[model samples]
Target: MVVTMLRLRKAVTNLTQPQFIEGYRKAQLIDVREPKDFEAGHILGARNIPYSQFRQRFKEIRPDKPVYLYDQNGGKSARAALFLRKKGYGQLFHLQGGFRLWTGKVKSK
Candidate 1:
């Protein structure tokens, strides 16, 4: 388990707000927060897949595309990245400080 976790961690790339935003436009931006959090405010163009539902709904994200993930404070997204990595995802990224530190364009429901 430890070895697998180490490998997964090596696969995930943590990105700063600007780096995340620059790649977000071209990648599959997945907001791993819950529905209420997503509806309150989320990065523009991000899709809500709530971390709670990820095990059942992860397929909604295309494995072939670059995957960018973020949560309210980065913890959930880190776990999400590990989950995706174990499922054979190659290109994985997450916001360093999560959405709270994001200073980019956002939209709300």
Candidate 2:
């Protein structure tokens, strides 16, 4: 007789704008768009870690906290989420419509 434990991994969730905003103050906001897009405008407090640089800069993100991500239209963030998940990140969330559809307070460079 043998016993084995199987662990399942959770996937990132697509959070609506409201739900995303509700936890903005408490989560790590990551803008996965390009630097130019991020410079134009982005959610306040979000760090611009372009998806292009994600692999090289992933170390900038902490795996312990809740990470909320967004991109031009959700595609990039989804990809980023998958990468993060592979790297052992458990708490991950992304904006449903990405920055192009975001209607929240933003900061500009």
Candidate 3:
């Protein structure tokens, strides 16, 4: 389990706010926070695929594209990235400080 966790950590890249902002537009932006949090405020264009349901819905994200994951902070995104890596999805990245640190524009439902 430890070995697998290490491998997953290395497989996903952690991007700073600026870097995330720079690349997220071209990647598949995913918000792993719960639906309530996602609906309150989320990065513009991000799709809510809450970590609680990630396993069942990860396939909704295309493997052909880069995947950017984030939550209120970074923990959930990190785990989500690990799950995606194990599932053979590459081009995985996450916001270093997650959504709360994001100074970029957001959309609320």
**Cα lDDT listed for each candidate:** 0.92, 0.87, 0.91
The 10-residue segment of model 2 with minimum total lDDT is 1-10
Steric overlap count per candidate:
0, 0, 0
Rank list by lDDT = 1, 3, 2
Over 6-51, each residue of candidate 1 has an lDDT whose tens digit, in order, gives: 7656979999997887798999999999999999999999999999
Q: What are the per-residue Cα lDDT tens digits for candidate 2 across 2-109?
A: 121112114687889999999877988999999999999999999999999999999899999999999989878888988898899989998988888888999998
User: Clashing residue pairs in candidate 2, if any?
Assistant: none
Candidate 1 lDDT trough over 10 residues, lowest sum: 2-11
lDDT value, candidate 2, whole model:
0.87
Instruction: Please give, for residues 2-90, the per-residue lDDT of candidate 3 as tens digits.
Output: 89668766979989998888898999999999999999999999999999999999999999899999999898899899888888898
Best by lDDT: 1
Which parts of model 2 have CA positions greater than 4 angstroms off?
Answer: 1-10
Q: Regarding TM-score, does 2 or 3 come out ahead? A: 3
State the TM-score for model 3. Answer: 0.92
Residue 62 in model 3: lDDT = 95
